[model samples]
Target: MTDRTLTVITHVDDPSIGVLEAAAADNSWSMTMVAPFRGDPLPGVADLDALVVLGGPQSAYEVQDHPYLSDEIAYLREAHAHEVPVLALCLGSQLLADALGGRSRPGDNGLECGFIDVTATDPESLLNGTFFSFHSDSADPPPDAEVLARSDRYLQAWRTGRSTAVQFHPELDGPGIEALLALEGAKLRQFGVDVDAIRESIPTSGPQPGRRLLDTWLDDVPVRDPAHH
Candidate 1:
């Protein structure tokens, strides 16, 4: 029998997560991708068994610049209301925060690009080790959210109902690292980001953490049963 379907939402092409695909395969699940950057229409909650929102370069609060983000947030809120499971990263996580009455913005400590280690609130957290980080913003969970982890500066992971969100990019691999460099390296350098350190951290960070995250999500999170093939 075929497994359940997981809907993946991407704001940009560069942040496509191979780990998500692999984990879906391992879990006997199928994946469908929706790209707002490419003008893809957002899928309804009924069309998904689970939802995953990937990282992007845009800030979550910039609804004016990225109008689709508002719709995305609305959809997420709807999904949550219906008890659908969600796993969101970086910008996606920020959006999730907004949907849940929380918020995110650029931090005073500067950009959190590259790999970083975090403190987990429990043993089952996906934030249990060093993972990829590539954003300037951090999320503040809602009053009822279960904060699973925290970075030195802000919240790293949280959950509310069936949804889980993380401020780090645990979905990135080598190609993803290269894609970020090719797309934003010069700009990041001009912003005083350490390209050398980010590059050095790449080898150590690898795709394992991302895969582990995907695996953990599949294992721990609640999902509707897979339909027959």
Candidate 2:
């Protein structure tokens, strides 16, 4: 309990855990960041008190182009088997699905970007509310997963054992969303997404429902003895 560690696997630079940094600080949890995109080695799951996999622009199915994704999928599978608490966002969620006997594919409903309202499909689910979303892919979670939430277009969140996966980002705030737009805004416009309008519509109230969801996950992460695992 004295050195709680949260390992973050980031696929890209832009979408680091936004609001979660503050949560880690407030909870006195130390964090280690791993960037597979930059060829940083992934620390073993046993070293972690919890795990977080951030979003990225890469499609989960493009393993041929990004072979490191295979490594990550294996890593995630190991973590899941160990009952490690995982909070997977966007691309990370897709990867988790792929690792857990599920599937990730191009969304039939097209791109689900901007702030979208997600409804809790399970009545007892703790996840519901507006979360930032910017992705063209979707995960059909593993058969055993408890489907928790969804947007009108696709599955938004699900839980299986100790892992919780969300297709929408719960870690992004206004500035984070703005930075993401700055990186891919033009590409979004090609798909009829009004980047400028999304920018204008950015909430000034700061991160909310997302932060609440994150807090719920944090509270549920189990602390483990290093020697025991």
Candidate 3:
């Protein structure tokens, strides 16, 4: 654990994992970044302490258009199969679902875009229930995955083996949300989103300390065993 190194895969620039980086720093973990959208090479999962896949606007099912994502899903399967830790966010979560023999597709429940309450069933919510969201896709957990959190509309979080996935954006903050809306507001409006209402829903002040519960998840990532791969 002395040379703890983690990898983060970011699809786009805006919604980068802001708070989660701090959690990584808290443990002095070094992060290697890969951006498939930019054509960065995906690293071998067995080589790192953990794998973190960040949110993006693309669907996990969009591999045909973004074929590099097929490589990503393949890496996730290798990671899961070898029992490496994974913390997949939003689109990454969907990719994890697909890697685990499930899928993420557009749902009839409409878009869940904005700050929303998420019910935690495992350890339960000790802090405020709200987490930021901006996607229409939902996922089915693998047969062995534990449903950790949810909203009335979608599966917010789950885990299988050492891998954890979440549809919400716990890594996003005020400026990040503003940037996301700037880029996607028009398309979201076409989906029946009220831009002003969503803006108003954002907390005026900084979020509570426990805002990034990923700290707990990262803390629990099991040590990588050379033989496991």
What are the per-residue Cα lDDT tens digits for candidate 2 across 1-229? 4758889998876455668887777777888889998899988778778999988878899999999999999999999998889989999999999999999899999999998888997666657676788888998899999988888998998989998899988787778888889888888988999899888877788555478777778877877867867
Consecutive 10-residue window with the lowest summed lDDT within model 3:
203-212
lDDT of each: 0.80, 0.85, 0.81
Q: Which candidate is the best by TM-score?
A: 2
How high is each candidate's TM-score? 0.90, 0.94, 0.90
Candidate 3: lDDT of 115? 80
Better candidate number, 1 or 2, judged by TM-score: 2
Question: By lDDT, highest first, what's the ranking?
Answer: 2, 3, 1
TM-score of 2: 0.94
Clashes of each: 0, 0, 0
For candidate 1, write residues 1-229 as lDDT tens digits.
4478888998876455766777888888888889886889987676578899988878998999989999899988998887788998888999998998998777777877777888899977657888778777877787799989987866788999989998887777666776787688898898888887877767645356778777878776555644510
State residue 19's C-alpha deviation in candidate 1, in Å.
1.8
lDDT of 3 by residue, 1-229 (tens): 5758888899986445657777788877888888878988877766878988988878888889999889999889998887888889899999999999888788658899988888889555532388788888888878888888888888888888888888888877666777788888999899888987877776767753335586777777777778867
